[model samples]
Target: MEQWKKNLAVLWVGQFLVMAGMTMIIPFLSLYLQTDLGLSDPHETATWAGIIFAGNFVTSFLFQPLWGKLSDRYGRKMMLLRSGFGMAIVMVLMGFAQNPWHLLLLRMVNGTISGFNPASVSLISATTPKERMGFAMGTLQSGGIAGTILGPFIGGLLADAIGFRPIFYVTGLLLFLASLLAMFVVKESFDRTKAAAKPNVSIIQGFASLSRIPQLKSLFAVTFLIQFAMIGPMPLMPLYVQELHGTAVNLAFWSGLVGSAAGLSNMVSSPLLGRLSDRIGQERILLVSLIGSALLFIPQAMAGSVWQLLVLRFLQGVFLGGLIPSVNALIRKHTPDGMESRSFSFNSSTLSLGNMIGPIVGGVISGWIGIEGVFITSAVLFVLNALWVNRTLLAHRKQRQG
Candidate 1:
């Protein structure tokens, strides 16, 4: 009925499509490198797979803030179209790579052009009422989570049915269709006169200005930590699954289920927690989620069975799903008006940073302390983040009261 609601619906589909297209390659990536790219060595294939996979996040991290700042000057819907179409082209091109190097280069470029998620968040935050920010962000998160949960499962089926290269073609086609639809459907209202009146600040200056705010600065740290801790253990999940499932033939199926467990629960709970955060306060939600997530990780590290690990991970998602929506809401609450896009872009950059570094850190930690240690490491990070967030919120309360 409302314009904001319309934007949310359109962007929700767009996010789902974009995330699905991006993640669909995950299940078969190493296999593709080995089978399609003609890599003979298992070690080389694994190395190349890790490189190509991390490549996107590396470039995306560097560019997201730039895109976000530009969106503030221009508009979020425009940025969305740019990212959507650009990614569509890249996704299709990925299917055409003749070697690991070519595919790696193409993946890097995909990262450089990636801004759809940040742009969508900025668009929704700008359009939705502040009171509904949590619910809107939460619902928006569920779309991507659902896509993430289902993408690999669907990709695995398609890979078997049609093959890997064709799967990329299908994913690219779906993403392209989404972008074309958004060209007509997605809408945003901006105060151009105000935008024109606003001084033209360089990206660095714009970033500096936003990060100068104390609350925003703290929030940014929380974002980085959340992502770092949450994703750091991801690269180890398959090996961990193998360790638990030992000598099982259906390792792929179990690994896929384990990988999707958190996302499935997150998709189911993000909106509910988000709505609750809207009423109860996002800060409280963030605090409880951090602690609950930390505690959940402990059981995961100790789980003796694959099913036990899956159950713990699912429960972890129930609370951890609240963290991002609340963090995004707090960023909106603390950031100055008219700069929401840049702030969110910065948030996206931190997320990308976590994605990029988390795996590397997990690998190194796993080497030294082993897989279970990675969970302990993640739990420690979560606890530290919770403490920082709790202390920051307390100071804000005191500052307001005083």
Candidate 2:
């Protein structure tokens, strides 16, 4: 097999393990605060949980560009290992935390060091053939989605069987193992001498250089909106399920199904849409997907039954799967040579920013106008995103052709 193919294969597993380890704590984070850390007040436990959870994204959002610049200077594989191993140590330390502050601090540190996903993306984008970029990004996305879908479920189960602290240890072990696998198996053709030969630029200059390109700027916006729309409604989903189900029995089970439905379909469809985009155009797929997802959200807002919402979310995921891979492919196509990692890193920063803000905005919107309004609002955002794509990407293609 080709070296790029081997890199993709190993990195896919690495992405899966890394994502799974990161998300494994979510199912019982508040429980850990209450039981182990001795937070007596329910409100305090909830607040600490939110803070600790968002702590990672806060630092990650701020520092991703720095890592991106360094990756361009050094090598993407080195950045990947740095993140993988750094996060491994952080995860293990969380298991030994005696207070919520310790966990919060560790999570922030983990975020500061976190770059595994973006590093893997940079490496893959650097190595994969232009024609295969869509397929590679899509396949890689499916792996992460698969991990996200399963992580909470597995975490919840393990939390019951082996208890919470041990789950952290297990998560740390998984990350370590993934790093080991990458260190041994994944091969990058990055040229350190050539990379170092290029003049070093500040992170601000790198961002400015990339943002000057209209296409890349638009792709970054698309990345932000894609994540914003997807993650915004997630925290409210269980309440929405309860509303639709109109009962308490099996509520957890039904809620879990609703949560995983879109991810499951997304995992199935990303590669398919990616290959299709390769034949047609990434921009076209992206625009159509934005529109399709927007329309689906309108009905989801009005869904009267949990079953209806589940089905709509599943259908929506089919479209959502196309968004990121297409964005990544287009980013690679448009980014200037020698700036690929920084470009991808800036995009990752937007992603982290979206993840950090989406839930907060969603919660606020839900409070003001109910959960349904949040859905309608997200739909509107997607529509705006589609228009942005049309103006920036598709219109340019026509202009060049003409």
Candidate 3:
């Protein structure tokens, strides 16, 4: 294998392991809070569980740009080492938690310290040739998606067999292993002296880097809108499945299947889409994906059977797969070569902001309007995003051309 491919494979393994560890909790965390943490009512459980989950992402939103800038200044490998070590420490700490508060606090801490994905993206972008950027990012993201596919299954099994705490321990150990390998073996190619002498820019200065590029502004807008649209369907899927009369025994199986279905589509389609973006242009694929995705949710909104939902979700994933890689491609195309990571970090943070709101909005809409209402809301958001991309993005492209 080529050296970059080999390095990418190694990076993917670490990412998969860490993601697998994290995935185990996604399906079960709400249950854990209610049962293990002794919350008395479903409402209380929902509130606290929602808080815990959303809180973790809050820190992720705050620290992403900072980590991106750090990667730009120091070295990608160093940033990876920091993220791995910090995440391991936090995961281990989470394993020892005695109460919900403890777990929530640990999750927040982990989120703040966890810059693994951003760091990894930066490292890969820094090393990969620009022409191959989308393919590389797609392959790397697929690894994480693969991990996500396995995470719920493995986590569900581990939670059932060994207990949640042990799951944390195992995941922490995996993260630690990933950290060790990253520190010892991963080589840095970017010259820090060159990156550093450029400037000791502040956080605002870092953001200004992105705004300086006109195309980046439109790209960021598309990113935020896509994430916002996509997030609504996720938190409510399991609940929607439950309402369809899915039993506990099969609940994990189907819910996971639904979750994994999109991921599976993403895994299969991401690379292909990324490669296609390289040929046809990132903007075209992104537009197609956004418009297709918005339409997909309409069927989901009207899905009467769990099986129907699964098929729609899987197809949705096929289009959704194009989104990140294409956006990343756009960034790579527009950004100064060495500053790809910093630009992507700003993008990562923007998506994190969308993630932080997606669930809360989904949950509130489900509670007040109806579960199906969430889909309508999602569809509306997605459709709006599609329009925004067409008007703002294509307009910007035409203006630049003239």
Candidate 4:
């Protein structure tokens, strides 16, 4: 196989396994806290669950850019092994947690160590020719989507048959195997002489790179808005459905269906949309996606039945799925070759910040306004973002040409 192909395959497989491991834990984490830990109040359970879950990404949010810069300096391969293998060990340790606090600590540890995906992206991006970057990223992202699609179903079955603890063990083993594959199959192409001769970098200096590019600035702002919109509905969607349906019967099944709906849609449309972006430019596709996302949520807010919500969510998933890969592709275009990982790291960190704040904001709005309010708020954000992108980024490009 060509070296680039080999690198992509290894990264894809590693990403799949790591994401699979993460999925097993995330969807079931609240249940583990509620059932086994004997959490009585639903609100309290939700709070603790949110803390543990969000905390992981919070730590990762702070560290991702740092890791990215390090990958640029040291080697992307080393960062991948460290993040993949380190997270695997943390997942295993989490299985032994006796309380929510313990779980929270383990998650924080895992996040602090997390940098594998960014590392993989940097390595793969380095190996891939510029013309093939979009397809390469789309294909790699598909692996993550595949893991997400299968994870909840498998986790649900495993938790039912054995327990959440056993699921963790299984996840840990797979992650470990992924790390090994990455270690063996993946190779680094960092030009140390080039990096070393470049200007010395600090932690803040890495973040400072964001301000240097207007396109990246626009991309980051738009991404933050879109992600914020997406986060609001996620945490409260199941509860909203159950309340709307007036029963807990098949709640798990329905919730799983809803949760995976986007992944299913994403799987079908991501590559198609990404390819379109490659041809027409990511900015054009981004505008279309934003508009599509905004329009989709209108139906979701107006959904009369659980089935309607699922259908809207599926469509929303298809449109929303294209946004991330397209955004990554755009960022890749703006960033220099050696700094690919660091750029993505900043992007990932910003995304984590969005995820961290999104749920809290969503939950509060849902409580203060209504469940449908969450959808409305999300929709409004998207529409505004679409306008912003058109008026600013697109207009700037035309102006430059003129």
Query: Which of the numbered candidates is closest to the native, going by highest TM-score?
Result: 2
Q: 354, model 1: CA deviation in Å?
A: 0.6
- Per-residue lDDT tens digits for candidate 1, residues 270-349, read 89999998898888899999999999998888889999999999899999889998998888888898888899989999
Candidate 2 residues 245-313, lDDT tens each? 988699999999999999999999999999998899899999999999999999999999999999999
lDDT of 3 by residue, 38-101 (tens): 7778888878877887777899899888888888888888888888988888888887877889
Best-fitting candidate, scored by lDDT = 2
Ranking of models by TM-score: 2, 1, 4, 3
lDDT of 4 by residue, 1-402 (tens): 988999889888887887777666666778999877778788999889868877888899988988888888878888899898898899888888888989989999898999877787777777887777767777788888888778767887898899878888888888998889878887776778888888867768766766577888777787788778888788788887887666758987787788788888887787788767767777787888999999998888787888888898898888887788778887887786667778888888877888888888998998899988998899999999888878867787678779
Which regions of candidate 1 are displaced past 4 Å? 398-402
Name the runs in model 2 displaced over 4 angstroms.
Answer: none
Once fitted onto the true fold, the runs of candidate 4 whose alpha carbons sit more than 4 angstroms away are 34-46, 399-402
lDDT (Cα) of model 2? 0.93
All candidates: TM-score: 0.96, 0.98, 0.91, 0.93
> Which regions of candidate 3 fall more than 4 Å away from where they truly are?
30-43, 243-252, 367-369, 392-402
Q: What TM-score does candidate 1 reach?
A: 0.96
Please rank every candidate by lDDT, starting with the best.
Answer: 2, 1, 4, 3
Quote the RMSD, in angstroms, for model 2. Answer: 1.0
